[model samples]
Target: MVTNLRADAARNRERVLEVARAEVAEGNVSLQLNEIARKAGVGVGTVYRHFPTPRALLEAVVGKELATMVQLTEQASQMQDIRAAMEFLLRRTLDLQLCTSGGLAEVICAIEDADERTTHAKSEMRRLADHLLERARAAGVIRPEITGEDVRNLMAGLERAVELDPDRADVYVSVLIRGLSG
Candidate 1:
């Protein structure tokens, strides 16, 4: 009976965390405990019992996003064609950033409070990015002199362009991808 109670409690916390992550990633950072509880289908008190405070919940959500990004970068590194993988990473990342609400701000904000796990995740992402650039260069799909920092800056610029002129995001991304190919 005690085990079942513990499991149920854990499940509630997981559900709350999931909803909090989506909400924050969607740029709704002013998350209310009541709303989170309502979304997670748990009691308001249950959320309080799990997170104690909104910051705790937000921190957990940020950690979850960082972990997710690390997994994605790892997956990208394993793709057969580094160029295609890079394109996929850019498109998918931008899509997530532009989905309903901007995720770039969320990512930037979370990075400021990055814990050890988040820091490691970011480092792993950078390592994977470097590997991808090397592979793409070796394959003659990208300029040999191009570095991971260049690609990272390009992505940041692209995100900014999209934020400034959302309707032309597709055009901007296409041009950037073509430029990278050269």
Candidate 2:
């Protein structure tokens, strides 16, 4: 969507995106465009000119991280070693849950009315789930009963738990992975 921009405008847009993403990642659910503009050394009009609404800005923040996760998951799923896939997934899940980006994932997941844009997220998760669950089960690593839905629920739970104690997420992840095995 972002094709071309003046140098100053491009810098301003990048600045807003970075600061807005960081703020939202830090649990600032109500972060506004004006605040982002102020932080970016630009005027509110400039921010609004680029991003129409707060939701749009938040969506951009979420989408940026979502793209990264999609690439990571897709890449990991293709790995020949099942343990590598599982470990990659675990690391990604832990990062998303414990890092500032965790907040954005939680917000996106919590939305009651997920539009067309969000629906694609589910499909991508299913891809990761199928890859990991099948490999884990075939290797007799984890139980066979765990489905893709189960994985999704686990992710949501992990996100919630990590939000409560970001510092303890590593411990929680270790315990959770252990429980996943047979």
Candidate 3:
């Protein structure tokens, strides 16, 4: 009896987390606990039992976002054109960051010390960015002086721009692309 109860509780918690992630992704971070429970097909008490606070739920959603970014980076690595891949990643990343409340900066700040998945994702993102930058430089598509850090900083700037004024994100992204292209 105890084992079955524990298993059910675990399943319910996972369901709640999954639903919460979707909600956050859709810019619904302020969704009430009861609403989440209803969406997850669980009781309000179940959500409270799993995530005691709104911050905890947001933290979990941010973790999911991080994992998604890592996956996107890995996918970008498979693209044939380095510059195209970089552009795609930048656009996709900006879209995701803008979907959330405070953008990537806030999500990153929420995480204290990332878990293994987040850490691995960060490393993989860095490696792919470096590889893409090297290829772009070699192909003369991007300025030779540009480094991976520069690309990251540019994305950070984009995040801030999106956070401040989402309507102008496209303009900022265009400038970033133009500046990178040789």
RMSD, every candidate, angstroms: 5.2, 3.6, 5.4
Specify the highest-TM-score model's number. 2
- Candidates in order have lDDT scores of 0.72, 0.72, 0.73
What does candidate 2 score in Cα RMSD to the true structure?
Answer: 3.6
- Candidate number with the higher TM-score (1 or 3): 3
lDDT of 1 by residue, 9-91 (tens): 98898899889878975668667989999999999999998777675566566654556666777788899977788788778
Model 3 Cα lDDT, one tens digit per residue, 1-182: 11445788989978988887788766676657888999999989888876776665665667756777777877887889877887888898887676665435454443343244545666777787777777778888789999877776677678877777878887888889989995
Better of 1 and 3 by lDDT: 3
Give candidate 3's total backbone clashes: 0
Best by lDDT: 3
Separate clash counts for every candidate: 0, 0, 0
Q: Which regions of candidate 2 are displaced past 4 Å?
A: 38-43, 62-64, 107-122, 138-140, 163-167
Off by over 4 Å in 1: 1-61, 99-113
Error of 1 at 87 (Å): 1.0
